[model samples]
Target: MLVELVGQSGRDLDNVSANPARLVNVYAERTTEGERVLKSVLGMDRHTQLDGVFVRAMGRVDGVTYAVCGGHLWRINLHGSANDLGAVDTGRATLCGNNGYVCVQAGTRYFVYDPDADTITEPAAGAFSDIGSVEFFGNYTVITEAGGRRFQWSALADPTDLPGLNFSTADGKDDNLLRGLAMDGRLYLFKQESTELWYNTGEAGADAMARVAGGVWDIGLLSRDMLCQFEGGAFIVGSDNRAHLVSSGGFQPVSIPPVETAIKIDRPQACLTYSDEGHTFCAIIFKDSPAWVYDLSMNEWHERAEGVNLGPWNVAASCKIGKEWAVGRNNGEISILRRTNADGSTPLVREITSRTLRMDGQRTILREFEVFPRQGFSAGTMNLHISRDGGSTWTPPKPKPIGGQGEYGRRVLWRNLGQARAINAKLRWTEPRDICLSTQARIVT
Candidate 1:
């Protein structure tokens, strides 16, 4: 019988019991270039690992980019050159840019970078000190204290002075923890157990900040690094242990059940989030597992594309400088994604693992297998591996031609795949470009 499989979708590794969602290196989508699936976000391999175990923060000021990794700040020049600024002795780094400077907070210490002078130094003696995190709104530099219950902003436009500025949410009520987010003309205070909205009270000079009339109680933010501002509001990890989109209509759940199941709550403090323009998606990463991507256009959840190793790629932090989207790797390397090839110098491997197909308790015989590449992918051969018994083992990989460019609709076939009680498949490619493809199987009962 000719069993025609539909288009392959993005990776759905969490779903081990069903088929229909095509787990692939890229998902199918119609673009201006024609109907094609995603190509794995290309990475800069020649840049290898940086001098740290993981990248903590990324920022750009005056055309110069910086990354906080291994407790030290490093100047990153995407052309493969970097300069370390020394150790910070902090577990995580919080960065915010204002005016012409970028401020960095590590533990109880704070430092500001002057890009014009190429200097990184602590603020003056009378300036604000002992800050845990930093955010800038207008000319005001806002910060939370170490183990403190309130947040404060600089006096006037000076982050180096404190005798005059008086902006804070210190109502002597609760410990309004976490960093502050300035959005839609209000300051959003995220506590460990609740959320508060504060706005300007029209009170001159000093008494400008005041809490909103009614705050969203009960719902609190969980991950500090996972907070992201989208077109509507912000997507964050809520106290309910699920991902939520907090906006004007109040907070609502957006993360699916499988994603919530994979989140490492105990590791909440380490999660990270960023947006991808190439794929039009937002990604929230729980360090211990494969990261989850939310399609901003579709408002649906999917897994990050996988490498040929058949495992999730390790991306710790991401930031956009100019038009390039760069990611900091868990291994301390900083590279750009969404390129046509892998890092230009290193050959990146791409893989696709299909969802489990059930034979309904009947042994199924695979008579033949057929593959189709996108109209543009012409030139390399792809390898195939078949797995039975739920991925316990896979047959030796088989190689098939992917055809050359201009050879659209060309099909490659393999005969006698052997019988199995249950099965799935994996396809890998090393020299593939525009490799959006589909497959079908000829089976016998």
Candidate 2:
């Protein structure tokens, strides 16, 4: 009899006893015939390395990409050449631009960059300080005061002009503002214990923006960096320890139980979103845990890690430069995703662990396990490890060659002579070759 090894969707729940299907560095894609198959994720290749220690944030303005790497602001051209614009603070930064000017809020200071003249200038000292987050809306730059209930806006068409009296307080709830987002013709003020939605009224000064009546939500934001705009809404890791999609309707939960459990354990430090191929992926990065990515197109979740130690996907910020998706790492490197199996020179290890199969305490006889991997790869091997005791321990790896070049009729089969009441299995590979698997795996008793 044939049993399903890989399913149509990825589900890695919190409770292993309930479900143990783990998809790492791979996702389920529906073919033209509506058959679900596993496909390896695109790898990252080095675009350029800056002279800074960490690439904190990235943004694009007027067809130019700018990044805050270490204490300097860089202008990255189309050919992966970085020109140091000037020096800025080194902490986490947020970049937004409008009217040919880019506004950067690094640490507690805000700087405005004009690509036309190649000049970086700090806003008037007393104009703003202690900025928690920044965004551009209605030709104005908006900012939230850290640890306070006030949000301010810049002069019309002038991001560097912030009038002293142009600020308003989001006091619908007695919570402090954590971030400010301008999206879909509205401005969202996220606080520690709630969120308020406001809209532009074309008024002057402090009355230019007004809160929508009955637009307050009980859901609070965890951090300013954990929020990203997706589709027509926004994706955020709420203070409730779960990921949510906040749209015009309200907050909707998007994280699974396993994802929630993982977030609850380590908590996300930052997040970024970018579109590749036909899918939009929001990657949530933690301090000490693997990164979890949400596929908005398929509504599924998967894992992404780098190197042999399987650390968090080393992505600090990401933005699309022209038609290419560019990611900035903490090590001052910028990379672009391509159709390969390695992250530059480092090999990307893909892994998947199957859910435990329990036979009601009835031992099954020896059988053969077979997998159907896409053939015609130049060279590679798929290693399978079996666990008879529900993944408590794994057997030695058994490697099988995928196929040679033009060899499209290869079968990855493993013959075994063992019996078990419960069976668990894992498959892993690390090669700079294309690898894909069908959703079916057969086991004959």
Candidate 3:
């Protein structure tokens, strides 16, 4: 009888003996035939490069895309061109758009960009010296006063108009407010140890918004940029060192043990959400670690790295321009996310490691192992590696041709006269051409 080696799952380093699957640069999805298969992640095609060190934020207003690169704000044209609008504070930025205006908050300065006038203007300084977060809700620009428990809003539809008295304190648990988000017509106030939900009441003054009686979530936000809206809710890195999906139902922990373990080791600096070919992904980026991507469609996790050094994926900000997903990278490059196999001209290294297979501690004779590569693939080689001692070490790679164009009948097979009680297998490939593994390797024991 033949036994399957790999299947649909993410990395589980916490318990490798039980589940040792590791997906890199690929995600698992169910096909129409009800079989799960791994698919390559869409690549980033360079759109434009700006004269700055890195892009800090991106947003769309009045059908135009805007980005903050280094100390300047720029307008990105649909034809992959950029125009420098003006200067702004240099640092991480928060952008929120409403009513043809985009509000920007960066490093103790608050500004608003009006596309119709083609200008960026700093709003009158409010009561706070620093702004923690910005969000649009109920025709108002909401912001949290950094290092404090007070939250404020601007005049209706006017991001430049701020009244000193137009603010309220979130005294829910006496914790300092860290960030805020507007989702489903509700304003979510996030703090260091808890979150409070408030909704618009259409009233005047202090009664303009009311808190949902029982809408307090015990989980707090990990950082200012670690929260983003997805589907109908929000994905947040909580202060408890785990990722959670916050919606009307409540907070649902989404980070598995291995993912959480990575989070605990390296703090996430930013989070971005985007959709590609019917799949939604939430990417968490760290300063010195590889990016961890969560596929909402598959409920699995994967790793995305950039450059020869295998560092973090360079995406720093993202926004939708028309129908395409435009991403701003840490190196001041704006790119369009495409369904290709290469990041611009760089081919991605796709890999998957299967779980450890143990035959109840009984050694068995291994016969042959074969894999079914998707038809119509061209120009690439798949390398297989095996480990007999539960991933403590791996054998030398054995390469097999995936066939050239029009050579779809090629078979990837390996015959061996070996015996082992437990084994782990890994497959890796790097080619610009489209490659897909229709089914994992089948081993006869």
Candidate 4:
């Protein structure tokens, strides 16, 4: 009997013990290169560090990028210049640009920055205290207070001032305390049990400003910083621990069971979401758990682990700067997600396992193992490990030389492999190149 496995996908680390056949990785994916290594933007350099702490908020004003770490702010230019702007607030902060100013909110306090003057000022503290999150809806600065049930927008095109004491409340039964985001000219409100969208009234004054569209509060958002925009819509980790795609029509679960099983429920606040254009996937990362990546192109799931790749992404904050993704790690370093190797030293790790092969309760003998690689890209070496008796143990890895760059249409074969009732095979590599592997197994009962 011959069994072939190609394009390994669908990873559920929570169920790996029971389902080891899925192609999963610490930091790898299946592209034209069977098991290609995933890349980070760039190395952790001085540009990503601020006051010995990782950036907590990243935003852009005019053409300048700003990174906030602790209470200090740094102005970053396109030419890679980082200038300290002294100290400001404490703890984690959120930033957004409204009109010509950068609006920053840390805790219940607020600070506004004028990009042209390079100055920061506090708004007159009267209205809009206890704000939880701030995002822009059209030209208005939309805000949600600490508790749910109500949200408001600032005066048109303004972030420092609001229109009187105007506020709008969600009349839905599930409008409990949560977060919000502004996208596509609508304000998305998330709660524990439901989600709601509000559109602009264009009134310019009081009377609750905006109203919730009927029947859109069907699903809710989980994880505060876990909202990221995708090609068709935005993806969020639902309060139910599932991944959802929120578009104009509402949301639907895009996460598989394995993706759902890997979330760290206890540390929900520590989760971060980002879209990787290189791999074309949306990654949901948790500090205490391995990353669960959803391939946007294939709509599939894969896993990423630090132990798999020498240094996987454990980012605290991430944003798309220009065309690439810039992220700040917990260790006080800034890195970019790129196709090249990190600092030319980080090793890439990949692992692909085949589905269990059963001989219908009859003992079998394995004769040979073969692997096929896609042509054209640079290739290195892969080690093979075989397991009999239901993947409980794997044989010592045997060395296999992979085809190098320009070695097109290459195939590797290993002969004289022993067999049992059930068996699985694994392929692993640790190089800074691509590995698109397709495997074939020969067995006899």
Q: Judged by TM-score, which candidate is best?
A: 2
Ordered list by lDDT, greatest first = 2, 3, 4, 1
lDDT of each: 0.64, 0.82, 0.81, 0.64
**Clash count for each candidate, listed in order shown:** 8, 0, 0, 13
In model 4, state the lDDT of residue 108. Answer: 61
Q: Put down candidate 2 lDDT per residue, 93-126, tens digits, no spaces.
A: 8888979998998887788988778899988743
| Better TM-score candidate (3, 4) | 3
Candidate number with the higher lDDT (1 or 3): 3
What TM-score, to 2 decimals, does candidate 2 have? 0.96
lDDT of 1 by residue, 1-445 (tens): 5444434443334654444244434444446755434445444443435786778887776667778888888888766688886566556667777777777877677777666777777765332356667777656667766555567666556665544356455443465576677777677777777777777665645676777777656776775566766555777887677888777737788876666765643253344444444345556665455456666554655555445443455666666645666778777878766555564454566666666666887787877776666664458888888888766567898998866777766666777888887777777777736565544444444
lDDT of 3 by residue, 52-80 (tens): 87788898877789899988988898898
Candidate 1, residue 94: the lDDT equals 79
In model 2, the clashing pairs are none
Full candidate order by TM-score, most accurate first: 2, 3, 4, 1
TM-score of each: 0.81, 0.96, 0.94, 0.86
Q: lDDT tens digits, residues 219-256, model 4?
A: 67675566666555787888788888788757878877
